[model samples]
Target: MPASSLSPYTLNNGTPTPTAAHSQPGTEVELQPYTGGDSEREVPAQATDRSERPRHIFSKHRKWMTVYMVSIGGAFSALSSNIYFPAIDTISKDLGVSATDVGFTITVYMIIQGIAPSLYGSISDSRGRRIAFVTALVVYLAANVSLAFTSDLAMLVVLRGLQAAGSAATISISTGVIADIAEPDERAGFMGTNAGIRMIGQAIGPVIGGLLNSAWGFRSIFWFLSVFSALVLLGLLIFLPETQRTIAGNGDVPLRGLYKPWSYYFKLPKEWRNAPVPPAPKLEKLSWRTIVEPLTYVLRMDILVLLSWGALVYTIWSMVTSSTTTVLLKTFPDLTQWQVGLCFLPNGIGCVFGSVCTGRLMDRAFKRAETRYREEHGLANVNVKSQHDFPIEHARLSLMPYFSVIFIVSMALYGPSYDFNDLRRHFAGNLVASLGLQFIIASTATAIFNINSTILVDCFPDNSAGATATNNLCRCLLGAAGVSVIQPMIAKLKIRNAFLVLTGIAVVFSPLVWVQWRMAEKWRRNRLGA
Candidate 1:
């Protein structure tokens, strides 16, 4: 093939003209003219040719609105977990349970968090995103209401797990929804937006939890969550369209009965929304196989390695956040619940900042990778087929080392922030210095988490939710272990030593990213063949 043939459009004086780009003997679809710059690239012929690319009915505005809704949906999981942070001590005392027993509630929550997504992802992938989301929210709403009235430790632990089952899958389902609507090149930005919005829950949950706990006791936290979730669920039922590609291909399929949101009737133009389209395919019956499907990705060495690295990073971060209230109260005995909650403000700020920035950075990296692919292949302005040609792993992981360094340094300093002996002697004695370190730690770690999530979606574009569920399973389980041990570790080996251990673990796990980077392409190709 000639170098000029690489691009779909013929360049006329540096402008792309309408033309067929790729017409290889085995090519499935011919590329149409490139519309303009990087932003307005040619729509895939398959999009219009249903026999090839299913038509995408969502306008850009509609697609983004879907993202925002799912982002809010995903945020409930983070909100539920983070909101409980400030109430740990209060809940323990109220239930007449040991702090360790209270921590068990988190462990159960994490365990459910790990497992529930697989089931939810399966439902979302097969049945529909809307149904899966609605189901999860209903369960979550019920759990919150029950939790508000519970005074028993066992009940609290069980209710938390039910809450996890309800909310944990939102992250996976949201990723699946993004995959349904976005192309490989632009996925990170959308994923980043989703994550950024979700991180808001993480950032503000403690503050809200703290204030609510102080004002009306810890039970009020559950009441707030119940009310918030109910509102979100109502909005979702009314406005959130189904985005599972299998069911609502390209958002073109006119859904019926429960499949269609109320917005389908009012928000969309009747002609466009009611356009003739293929009927939804028969959904597979949910079985053990569907539940086990996500685990298959875990068996892939490259994905496993990537997941392991993410689990390590997430576990470290979870340990910190889970223990923060306890640590702050111990360090400053006079600190009230609200005061301790305020301490989390920096970390939350970092999460929001990091998620958004990392997403934009990932998009830029993908664009750079596209440019590099063209240069290497001696092509001009051609659309490099993302799945087969783009250096996706490298583009996504390019910023991993920087984040790793940030995490390591910040985590090391984090423990010492509370060590009065060290803080008094060192220049890092001030409150600002302490919180600044937390901010850095949260930002960098959250960036790493987002990067892993972005790459996972890239690797399994068709099964984005399933892939993310696998990631959630790994990280949440590891996080459960980390949360289980962190408080005890801090008690036995001062916060400083415990964090140093975490930092060392991060260093030890750093090479896993390199391994995944090296092997990702090969593994993906092998999977395709299989």
Candidate 2:
């Protein structure tokens, strides 16, 4: 018998046989021809079921799990930074320092917090996310523990810097995780969730710190933070999985190699190839080349100048509000720390509500445009793959006019009206201002993340994480610079003038938002291609 005529199974006489069922569908059943005299045995086709194919076990849970872990961790980390606000006066008295000096401690903490994110983000890209997260948590825990025992301002500043370093890892890495798991359409929702949680932590931190400080003095705040840090560290160690995509040559590429051609390294000997490829190492060769390459995108006439100015203005506005809260409470001598805490509760609520509303609106607007585009072209509904194609301006348009009104109301009326006689007005202004801040922040942040991340990905698609890390670095570094100067500006210019300055800056930048909104599609087309 020909080999093609034989079945999958062998007979008793060693002759192969074909099974009737295993034959091609719709074909007549055929018998196997036997080379030997003995009869042939038939073989059946292997059983297969559509449902038995291998599928991702954790795929469904991965995104939410990661977002939840990172958000919670990030919230706690941010809480540690600001929870000391209620204790600021107490701490200053204990350390024999002025309020301004004590304020510097917060400034230093903010500066460090801002600086560390980009560095850690780059590390997370080069190393694995799990390692970066775990390492950061451990460092954070240790810093909190150390902070619990610190008595002097110098020690406090150093330990706070270390704490900032650890916290920075969570913020940047969580962002990268969001980019990794979410489709662009879903990213704003994820970012909103992350931002919301962080705001909740910020809301709770001062209040909790106040209660703790009242009951057990300022030192006890660090002890509570230490416990929180320890819990976060354990949770992360157990639950946070690695998410960085592992591509060959990705880890091995050096700072110098970025500028060098691949052909230079590819020509090496087999012995060099066989040598055990070393594990991923930190790229510490911080040259102008490395620094400038990542920042080149930001330096573009169309990009960084506007973003930097807007971020600076926003930071100043936020800093003014934060600084004034403590001072404002001092005016109400009858109000305890607990009352101050209660006052801030409304701000948190407003933030959460505002962020959710803005996120939904942006998402809805993008979907509407997508639907319109499809309808106008007379095409059937299809999956929209990249968010890059959506109009980035709609996100900004939803935000600017609302925030501009709020900003004007806040600066012009809120400050001058706060009197010890009428606490209700103060509370109302705080609530309104908080809502406005949320609108401004959520809109700008979502817009920045949507437009900038897409731009970064398009600019350096092969190294999206690295590109994002650099963008994060600029934001943080400038934020740190802003942190350092914000208090001084407020103190020198006074709250009203400070706010007026902020308002002026915002007003100037407001036009840019419009410009960006109007030209965004053109920029996208020119930069990313139609």
Give the clash count for each candidate: 2, 1
Instruction: Report the Cα lDDT for residue 287, model 2.
Output: 47
- RMSD, candidate 1, Å: 6.9
> What are the models' TM-scores?
0.87, 0.72
Worst 10 residues of 2 by lDDT: 47-56
**Compared with the true structure, what per-residue lDDT tens digits does model 1 show for residues 250-275?**
66567776778897677765545547
List RMSD in Å for every model shown.
6.9, 14.8
Q: What stretches of model 2 exceed 4 Å from their correct place?
A: 1-62, 247-293, 377-390, 393-401, 419-476, 481-494
Q: What does candidate 2's lDDT look like per residue over 1-530, in tens digits?
A: 44467555655334443354343321112132333555454332121121222111234366677677887777755587557777877888888887777777776776676667666666666665666677778888888889888889899889988988887667667766665555444655666676567667666777888898888888888888788878876777655544554422322222122222233354532323455644554444544454345556665544564455445544654464356455455445555766665555544554455545555555665567667765765544333322335454454345545554555455554444343235564343544453444344434443443444443443343344556656556555666566566667766865456656756766666666567666755665565444
Task: Report lDDT per candidate.
Answer: 0.81, 0.57
Model 1, residue 153: C-alpha shift (Å): 0.6
